[model samples]
Target: MITLGHAQAIIAGAIAHAQNAALKPLGIVVLDAGGQLLAFARQDGASFGRFAIAQAKAHGALAMGDDTAVLAERAKGNPVFFGSLVGVFDGGLALSPGGVLVRNGDGAIIGAVGASGDTGPNDADAVRAGIAAAGFATGAAA
Candidate 1:
């Protein structure tokens, strides 16, 4: 279970990493395994579009059980199918980057973290750092 404490820690860790790296102001979203929003925040100066993007990125990862980067690749290879998913999901999915799954000791997915405001890789790095700080395992790269 992803508790409030865990969510707060995840956000703090992600923000700390982004600050340390001098990345742009970020918006982060955490979601439970069932795709419910757990915690969310947007740093000062984060863009208006960041919140939704971050949420969608997390939802996309949760829905597909893969990171957004992987989804991007899959979408690129099969635009029709991926596009259909986008439509079916009502635009709640993103296939760029910045999303990662959170797992427990048993390797069961417990949650996800998604971020925006930096480059795709940077966003992903922040999310990974956050999940690590929360003492959760990250599943496969996808």
Candidate 2:
């Protein structure tokens, strides 16, 4: 099991990166492999709506066993399936391009992280930095 401490560290690192970059405040979420929440943070001035969007992004990555970017692309080809999921999840099924899966040394996916309130590329960059800071490998999802 990935420790909560690691999750917290990843979130903190992401927050620091965002601060240093002067990016807009963000809502970040980390979820274990089982798609359970491990850690979360909402920077001051972040949108309240982003709280759920961040979790959805992370959960979508964990559920798909890949990064949200790939899932977003897949959604483009199968909008009905992906769109239905949003309804089923009651808006917690974000297929954005800002979520990343975290893998352990043995290449086992341990969790996923998601960020919102910045552009998709910037959000992805933050997640990558956080995953790297946590000492985990970031696998390409696409």
Candidate 3:
């Protein structure tokens, strides 16, 4: 099992990287296998709303066992189902492209991480960098 400490370190590293790069502040979240929040952080300048968005994105990825990018693509093709999901979650679920699934060495999905407040691609890159910095694999869903 991946500890919350590890998750926090990853998120912190990601945020530090973003800050060093001069990107906008971000809110990041990590969710366990059961879609429970393990750790979260809202950078000093990040928008308050980004906290929820980041969590929702991570939850969606953890729940679906796929990257949010893939889910966004599927949602584009199945608007009705995807639309229903938003309604079901009361607008908390996001099918955006910034969440990624985290898996263990045995190929079991351990959790997921998400970032918000940057562009979708940048958010994804930050999360990827964090995961890699933690000695984890990336593009697991791809």
Candidate 4:
């Protein structure tokens, strides 16, 4: 499980990382292990749909127990399987780079962070930076 404070730190850390890299404004979402939202943020200039994108990113990663980046790769080869999953999730599932699994020191899954409003890789990097800043780790399958 992820605490509110941890979620807030993740958002802050993600924004800071984006700012440092001069990336586009971002929308960030933090979700607990049960796929519930813990915290969210959208920076100025971020598009209106960023919330949906970010939420889907987190939702898909949590549901599949794999990071969105990996999911993206798998989706590329198995489009129909991933497409069915999206429907199963009521359009909540998204395969993209922004969704990264968060793990505790003991390597247990705590939650996930999803980011948008930049390049896919940048979004993923920002979330990873945020997790590290909040004293957590990033993992592929968690």
Best by TM-score: 4
Range of the 10 consecutive residues with the lowest summed lDDT in candidate 2: 133-142
Q: TM-scores of the models, in the given order?
A: 0.95, 0.92, 0.91, 0.96
In candidate 1, the residue pairs with backbone N, CA or C atoms under 3 Å apart (3 or more residues apart, or in different chains) clash, namely 67-142
Clashes of 1: 1
Q: Distance from true position, residue 56, model 3, in Å?
A: 0.7
- TM-score result, candidate 3: 0.91
Per-residue alpha-carbon lDDT of model 3 for 25-84, expressed as tens digits? 899998888888889888898999998889888888877778888899999899999889
Candidate 4: residue 59 lDDT (0-100) = 86
lDDT on C-alpha atoms for all candidate structures: 0.91, 0.86, 0.82, 0.92
Backbone clashes in model 2, listed as residue pairs: none
Better of 1 and 4 by lDDT: 4
- Over 4 Å off, model 1: none
Per-residue lDDT of candidate 1, residues 12-100 (tens digit): 99999999999999999999999999899999999999999999999999999988988998888899999898888899888878988
Tens-digit per-residue lDDT, 61-137, candidate 4: 88888889999999999999999998999998878899999988888888988998999899999999999999999
Q: Which of 2 and 4 is the better model by lDDT?
A: 4
Off by over 4 Å in 4: none
